[model samples]
Each structure stands twice: as structure tokens, then as C-alpha cells.
Target: MLSESKKFRFAEDEEVTKKLFEEGDTDGDGLLTYEEALKAFSKYQRPFSREVFENYDTNHDGKLSQEEPETHSFRIINKYHFCGVFQFSNVVSLSHKQLRSISFFILAWQLLICDIMSVLVQFLLVIPQTFAGYSLYSHTFSYAIGSLDTLSYNGALMFALLLTINRLCIFLFPAIDQRVFGRPIIYGVVSLAWTLLFVFFIGLNATRCYKTFSVQGFYLHYENCENNSSSIGVIFQGIKDKWGRFSTYVMLGIYTLITIWLKFANRLHIKMNKTDGKQVRTNKKEIMFFVQSFIICITFLLESLMFDSIPRFKVYGQWRYAVNFTSNCITIFMFTVHSVVIFTFNSRIKEQLKEIFASKGKYYFASVTQTYPLQTTIVVRK
Candidate 1:
């Protein structure tokens, strides 16, 4: 079964199989083969996204009614990120003091910063323009917004790949992990990646390749150039597609090996521990952490494909907006679910999150999706 709000409809179609992203293996044996696991992610993803949009619409009018987007979800996720960050401090918890020092935790911290930058673009530019109406001042300021958005987004993808590799190495090559992921070496690598990412986007910014609202005016346009067919546009798109494909394949590849190892290890341990076959046992904290990270990568992969494919599918008018909204849902879901998993896996965070939701107008990583009053009339933008 999938998690809350992610329960997928089962279908036998080939397309469904191709887009699959089942949560847990449905087998007497404790493992799901690669084919059975990720087969319906993109297929059912559309309708699942539609449901989310409905939850936001409130009036079922197929439009955003809020002045600011992602406010509730963003606050919840930010709180979780900050909690995880402070987990490393002795002042917060002596047991977690080493978290900030670890390379994995440091990379996670950087990814948090990148997410904030992406949210700033949404908070300042995209949401307001789409809701309140675009302004001359916003148009002029968008250059900087576009630049930061690109830098932060690509930075996130890079750091995610790094985190995946770091996790894999810790399992398979402890010595290499220690040597390569040492504090100085890890910081150096992250710095170099950042420098290269900035230089690349800076070159595109120089060529005047930037962004705009999408045709349906939902999400920000991926790339804006003199004309969509310009060489710079092609390069920008090519990089997006290739980078997306590479990250998906690498995450899938690394985890396949890890899954095999875990299965073998579990088999060996089961013989010694002697457990019942009927229990839906929770995973160890270490295993749970890895599983959560893998899920994040899967969500990112699906989100990228979902957004890119929207334009290509020739969706139009209101339905096009729905597709774009679905893409945004996936983007928020990816980040929001990360925080959810953190609190789920960590007792300290979980307790605080529980307390947060217990209070009125408060939330934790567990989504308290915000709602607002809406106008009865539908205002369609031409």
C-alpha cells in the first residue's frame, strides 16, 4: 500500500505498468522486482494530481483562490528542515550532535537551502503574478528571480545525486566513503558543483535565456528565449531532459544493488532471529532513512517527467492548467513528504510535529493544507 494521499489505482494497462510507483512489495517474499515496483507512477499520477487540485480549489472552480501559494505546506516543511538542522546541535540534543558534522547531513542542509530559493521564486513571482496579475516591476525583477530559481533547482538535483552516492558508498565502500566524504573533501566538491552550476546558468542568463509564466499561466515556464526554437532554448531543454534521465537511472541503479544486499542480509538475520511471517514489521531506523531518501528521488523523477510531458501532450485551456497544477503538486509533495518521513522516523521530531498540529492554525510535516474563501464567479484569463 502507498502512503497517505498516494494510494494509486490498480490498472492492467501497459502504460500503467510503465508509470508504476507502488509503495510496498505485494509478495510473500519480502521484495519487489524492479518491474513491479515503478510501473504506474506516471499513469495514475495525473488523476492523483487532479484530486490534489480539487482539494486546493475548495469551490471546485479549477482555480487557485489563495493570495500566496504553498504557505501552509512551506511552513510545515521548513519547520521540519530546521528541526533536522538543529538536531546536530548539542544545545538541542547531545545524542544528535554529530548529525551536522556528517557529510550526508551537510548535503541535506544544502538541499534545504536550495528548496528555500525555489520557494522564494514561487512566493515572490509565480504565485502573485498568476493570482493578482503580472506587473511591470515583477517583469523587470524576474531576471534575478529566474537566475536564482535555476541555480537553486539545479543545485538541488546535484546535491540529491551526491546524497544518493554518499548513501550507496557508506553501504558498499566504507573506506572510500570515509576518505572521499571527509568534511573538507565534501565541502570542496559541493563548492565546485555550485561554481560550475552558477557559471552555466550565468552563460544562459547572458544569452538572455530566462523564464515566463507557462501558456496556461500555471507554473513558471522552463525556459524563455527570443523564440522557443533558439539554440539557447534547445540547449536549456536538452540539459533538463538529460540531467533528469541521468538522475533517475542512477537512483534506480544504486538502489537495486542496495535492495539485493538488504534482502540477502535479511535472509541471514531471519534465520538467527526467528520471526513470524505475518507481521508488517517496521524497518530499522537506518533502513527507514534510506527508503525515505529513495522515495524522494522517485518523486523528483516523476515530477520532472510530469512537468516536461505536460507541454508535449498538447493539453489546452483549463485542462492544461490542471496538468500544470498537478506538476506543482508533485513538486510540493516531494519536499513535504521528505519532512513527513523525517518526523515519522525520528521520535524527537515526531513529538514536536504532534504538538504543532495539536495547536490551532499550526502544522507539522504532516500536511495541514490551507484553505480560503473563494469568489463565486470564475474569472478566466485570456
Candidate 2:
């Protein structure tokens, strides 16, 4: 006769466990012994339960009960870990939210610095013009000056787009991102993006090849050779023109669509749950953050296009300088504003930042998503 005593099963806690046992216990053995359970768990790298085996052995038997018992406290799976936080106590630990926040800041700094540096180089190139040394300026500064500005602009755009992709992963695919970038992969990607940018832009397009047709002989209008073009130079310039414009437009278009969807969805979510003021507010803020990012991305691209397109409109001399300087300042200012998007939209990030600064202890990692058990029940029957 079957004993009417207590029966236990870890299978009660999770359905998958029950299925595994049903499948693995092939000989119609109603229960898994300690060794059997250990063997099953050994198949996976996860922990096995010695306690489960003993608990199932209710009759002081060496084997488990025919029926299973529920087990509590399963392993905590998928914990987020920041690189260097564990080993380097001096460095600040970044939670997922904080990492998103800091990524925004890094992108902003890249744009701000690149725009300023490029403009400074442009300004220096023009300094010789102020002292009646136009020949000297045109001879020495012509190639290097334009090349540097183009390189800086391209480098900043490439970096910012890569960062945008990172943000997208953080918001959309947090789990996969945590699994993939949980190691030093993030640093590796950043380095690779920058190196690719340098190789494609600065290294490839260092020569002045793009020719601007200018009338050298006043009144008569005679066409003169203004630039040198090597075989590699033409290829590089062609690639830069084509790829740069295409990438800028592609990024701008994708982000604009994303922002639109987020905005509509947020509005619908808020409308459906007016009573939940916090959720509504959060949704509104998230929508705004994404919209702001989209706008900034578009503005950055448009600004670059406008600067490059200015010469085509017959705009030249001090007017160009003024436009260039003003554009540089505007881009830098926009970058600074872009840096605050994550902070403004994400309260959790603000909280983590506060904790990071306030604490004397180790840096805290914040979870982007937390799981809540909807229900739990304990049944004791004898």
C-alpha cells in the first residue's frame, strides 16, 4: 500500500523540472534518487539539489517518494554584471540604467569635442588669410584643413551611430545585450568602431581630391586645376561622398520612425491607464526621450549636410567662416543637451547616480528589469 505521508517534488515549483524528470526517468521509476537527480543536473551546468533528494526520502528510504515535492529558492538566473566593477573597486559600477546614461554622455562628448576641434582647425587655416597670405594659406592649409574637418565630422557621426545602436539594444534587447556585452565585448566594439572610422575616413581620404571649379582669371573666367587627384584619392572621395550621405540618411530615417512609434504607443498606453499616474508619466518621458534622440540625430545629420552644401550655393569667405563657427557652436550645444536625455527620462538612473555618489562602499549594479512572482502557495497535507 502507498504511504499516506508527505510527498515532495521540485517539479511542483517549476513545470520544466517535472517534464525533465518524466522524460529522463525512462525505466518507469516513479522517483529520482539523490544520484539520479545529481546526474540529471550534471547534464546542465546548473546546481543540483542534495536537499531535494533527502526531502523526498520521507520514509527514511534511500530513494525519493513516488510523488514529487515542491522546492523553493531556485537559482537566481541572468544577473547583470558590469565589467571591472568586481575587480576594480576604485572605478564606478554601472547599472544597466547608469550605463545607458553614461553612454549618452560619451556620445555627447564625442560630438562636442569633434565639432570644436574641427572648427579650431578650420579657424587656424583661415588665420593666414587675415594677414594677406592667401597664397600661403591655400598652398599649405588647403588639403590638411579640409581633411581634418571631414575626418572629425565623419568620426563623430560614426561613433554616435554606434552608441545609438547600443542604446537600442539596452532598451529593446536587454537580456541578449547583458549576455553578450556582459564581458569586455562592449570595449571591443567601441574600439573597432573607432578604428574602422579612422581607416575609412582619415586614412583613406587624407588627400585633397574633390575639385571645386573656381574662375581664376577675373572677368574672362578661365578654369584652373585647384586640386590633385591620385587613383586612391578618387576612390576614397567617391566612397566618402556616397557612403557618408547614405549612412546619415539611413540613421535619421530609422530613428524618426522609431520615435514616431514610441510616441503613439506611449500615448495609447497613457490613455488606457489614466489612473496609474506614475506609469503615464514614465511613458510620456520615455516617448520624449526617444523623440529627442531622434531629433538630435536628424539635426546632426542635417547640420553636416547644410555645411557641406553651403559652398554649392556660392557662399564663400567670412560668411562661410561665420556659418561654420556658428554651426560648430550649435552642434556642441546640441550634444550637451543630448547628454542629459537618459537622466531626464530615467528616474532609476538618477537614483543609481545618487547612490553611487553617496555611498562609501562598492558600486551598485541596477537591474533594468525585475521579475515578480505573481503567486506562490504552500500546501502542507498529511
Each prediction's Cα lDDT score? 0.56, 0.48
TM-score of the candidate numbered 2? Answer: 0.46
lDDT, model 1, position 164: 81
User: How many backbone collisions does model 2 have?
Assistant: 5
Best by lDDT: 1
Q: What is candidate 2's local distance difference test score?
A: 0.48
- TM-score of each model, in listed order: 0.60, 0.46
lDDT of 1: 0.56
**Lowest summed lDDT window (length 10), candidate 2:** 213-222
Separate clash counts for every candidate:
8, 5
Across 1-382, the per-residue lDDT of candidate 2 in tens digits comes to 1223323334334465666566546567686667776776677544445543543454445665445322111101001111112211221233333453344444544554555545454345433322221123343445556556556667767766765564455555668656544455655666686687777655454564422111110000001112536776667666766765766777776676565655585456536444587766754654455555565566667766865785477433223334444554444443333334444555665677668677634322122112222221111221
lDDT of 1 by residue, 1-382 (tens): 1112311222334344223433324443433333333332333452223433343332333443221122222223323434433332312232135466767556766666677676666666665544333232344577677667777777778887887888787667769888888878888888887897877787667666776443123456544464566776678656755876677778778888888877896576546356554432433644665786787567767877775576688553345445555666677666454445544555665565455447634443123232321321222221
Look at candidate 2 and give me any clashing residue pairs: 8-68, 8-69, 9-68, 9-69, 9-70
